[model samples]
Target: MSTAEAGRGPRLVPVRAADGRVGWSLVAANGRRLAAAVRSYRSDRELASGICELLAERAVLRFVLSQREDRLWIWTAHLPARSTRAGAGGGEAVARSARGYLRRDQCRQSVAAFRQGADHVQRLRRLAGGAFPSSAW
Candidate 1:
């Protein structure tokens, strides 16, 4: 069940892998996972700071949806490179959908939900086990 169905609101969850790598996942109100950090942080402190950085740059962050060679759709949120940096390519992807979608519309819906949840985030928590919330699966 989604968070809403489970009597919870959407929230950002900070997680730590068994290897001590940290990352964040955006969980939707319905309990579905929208997106997660593309790369893991070295520590919880770094994960927290990275989240702060993303929030500071959120206004300028860009969202893109694309199809993989496997024919699955995915979305990514990135920070565009400075225009003055001629050698720079596209911005680096910071977060991506937690899983691929079978259709473009499904991917777009996830992105839309991600935007809403992210903009109005009310709670942030780390699961007791430091893993993605089982409810999110």
Candidate 2:
């Protein structure tokens, strides 16, 4: 198993897409990517706001693990509804694993590792000009 899978905590790393849009990833201390934003943001301020929202809702967020038809297992994080009113099943997917796993056990382990470290996630400071050099899709 990799160091990240060994229960190491994760960090929030800024990433730049091919189109130059910026996003963020939850990466293990060993540099293994765990989860990432559902969509890219055009600016760091937007990215920071997104991160803040996620962090603020972390307590009520739910994590789900599923297997695709191709048999690849993956995990997704969802945000709960904002109100207790009827028809408020607002479980919107906000973050997902960076990659799919080959086995159900591995997928479960990834989820466990994520939960183990999510509460204490560290993030790098924003750079000047809002440019993140780490290339990610």
| lDDT per residue (tens digit) for residues 1-137 in model 1 | 34554336566777789998989888777667878998899987787677766655667889888999999999899976757677887777888989999999999988887776665452222332333244432
lDDT tens digits, residue span 59-98, model 2: 7778888988888999988988778999988677888888
The residue-level lDDT of candidate 2 at 87 comes to: 92
Best candidate per lDDT, number? 1
lDDT comparing candidate 2 with the true structure? 0.71
As a TM-score, model 1 comes out at: 0.76
Over 4 Å off, model 2: 1-9, 122-137
lDDT of each: 0.73, 0.71
